[model samples]
Target: MKTLSKMHGPARERGVVLLFCLIILVVLLAGGVAVMRSMDTSLAGAGNLAFKRDLVNQGELAIAKAMREFNASGALAATGATSNNVAAANYSAVQLATNAQGIPEVLLKKTDLNGPDVLGNTFRPTGTPISGSGGSTVRYVIDRMCNATGTFASIGKSGCVYTPSKTETPGGDQSQLATPGPSVPSPPIYRVSVRVDGPRDTQVFLQASFTKPE
Candidate 1:
């Protein structure tokens, strides 16, 4: 029988296991770093969304204040008040000029808080903020949806957007039939824009248009 002999033609591979282990370690480290970065981005996005939602909820306060001002018995609806612009009350009888964003130019003019806008039109005074706390402030402006000032009759139907006070509609009795009522002139639609400034330079703008009967 031929004698079996150990033939070592080349040096046995050394540190092969060590090299394999090092490569695996590097791959795992890279995966871990990628996962950590993804987590951070998700956390930041969630935080920003939460802040925005909270700020929007706070805008209800401004809406309530505007409703009060337009109350039939309130100062704004009093004799001669509705027909004229009241700067102190932050109200305008005519619609104000707006920017490309549809945001009132007056609200964008911060250099002079109460100065005129880019069109040289007087800024409707925002007056004092309706409410503020914890680095948040809420303010609003009201404008009648009309091209000209004065009573709705004087502005003519083409100059303003309005609806009659009493329109034929279904009553609250759950009946589908229409209920008839005499049509009477109602106040023109008024737009209220609320601005909320919050922490981290976050700002929210909201608008609501409504009509109040005289």
Candidate 2:
């Protein structure tokens, strides 16, 4: 009877050992699956960030185009040219309405000003979308920092943000000059807003402000 009992005891112990091995295997499998899922999520996040950075870098192209348009010999170079809204040039002499975030309402996809007078007239890259290396499209709008659209004299310096540079023979003060000092009209500040559209329906907005000689 003792010998028979010993044989049964060893057999039961073997079965218990096999059950423990299976439990350990199951635990390891679950841990491996969890790790793989975590890795995949991390990879996806990194890819999204990289794509956004690429889109932002591509915004420089729009900014460069706007600068050229505002420089001398460009369509917006003359003082009279900036006195009114030029839909073709995407230029506005008066300040544009902006959203709560300070983004121009004209550049928004859906806004009250989405008519031909505003959103429908934004300037694209030469009337077409300029494709970037990452398949992004760029557009921009320029607005002069003024309350109304008209001649500088009509709007007056108080109505616009103008920076005056003294050109009165260096040391000569305008108050002391015998005659009205040479009219040194400082440049007016212009704001350029750029929008970049990229893959996955991602959109990026960039803005820059500069002064150009009138």
Candidate 3:
């Protein structure tokens, strides 16, 4: 009988085992790479969502701060082109209409935020960081609810539409607890617009219409 060495049995068997091991190694490597990529993608998505939440929170803060200024000293009373405050950051209705389209984005001022050809960022720079504990800067604007923008008094025909503080949408037979009566004094409403910008090209805009008693 021929010897096993002469038949090349050991070498041939060893070669087959090595080939199988190499194939298994390649498969393991591929799986590991796929898992790593999936983890990286998940982390990136989570980070982006967190940044968005931060921007929204900053916007809320802007609205609150602006309201506080109103309550504290009526700081926003005459803050526009019509007012003598040359350093004011607000704009009059006529100014917004003539410069841009007219109503703001929230108020359907235009199709898009960049529309009407001119409704750019006109809020004041308080020098306060927008994120506070994060990145970017925050700025806000307060437009008194009115049709025209010369002064609060100039909104004549399309001026303040009084809805009670607790007013509800006119729908089903819900209790008319907050029903607004014409005899009630028309409380002033303010339109608050805020812009929050952050790193990696993050940007958010928020607007709210609110009223507070004098």
Give candidates' CA RMSD values in order: 5.3, 6.3, 7.5
Query: Model 3 segments beyond 4 Å from truth?
Result: 1-17, 77-135, 150-182
Model 2: how far residue 118 lies from native, Å: 12
Global lDDT scores for all candidate models: 0.74, 0.74, 0.53
Model 2, 34-120: lDDT tens digits are 999999999999998888888888988888877887678778877688888776677777777778787887777622223222333
| Per-residue error (Å), model 2, residue 176 | 18
Higher-ranked by TM-score: 1 or 3:
1
Ranking by lDDT: 1, 2, 3
In candidate 2, the residue pairs with backbone N, CA or C atoms under 3 Å apart (3 or more residues apart, or in different chains) clash, namely none
Candidate 3, poorest ten consecutive residues by summed lDDT: 109-118
Q: Show model 2 residue runs off by greater than 4 Å.
A: 1-11, 14-16, 110-128, 162-184
After superposing candidate 1 on the true structure, give the runs of residues whose Cα lies further than 4 Å from its correct spot: 1-11, 14-16, 114-120, 164-183
- For model 1, residues 5-56, the per-residue Cα lDDT tens digits are 9876987879989999999999999999999999999999998898888888
Q: How accurate locally is residue 93 in candidate 1, as Cα lDDT from 0 to 100?
A: 75
For candidate 3, write residues 13-57 as lDDT tens digits: 447878999999999999999999999999999988887898888
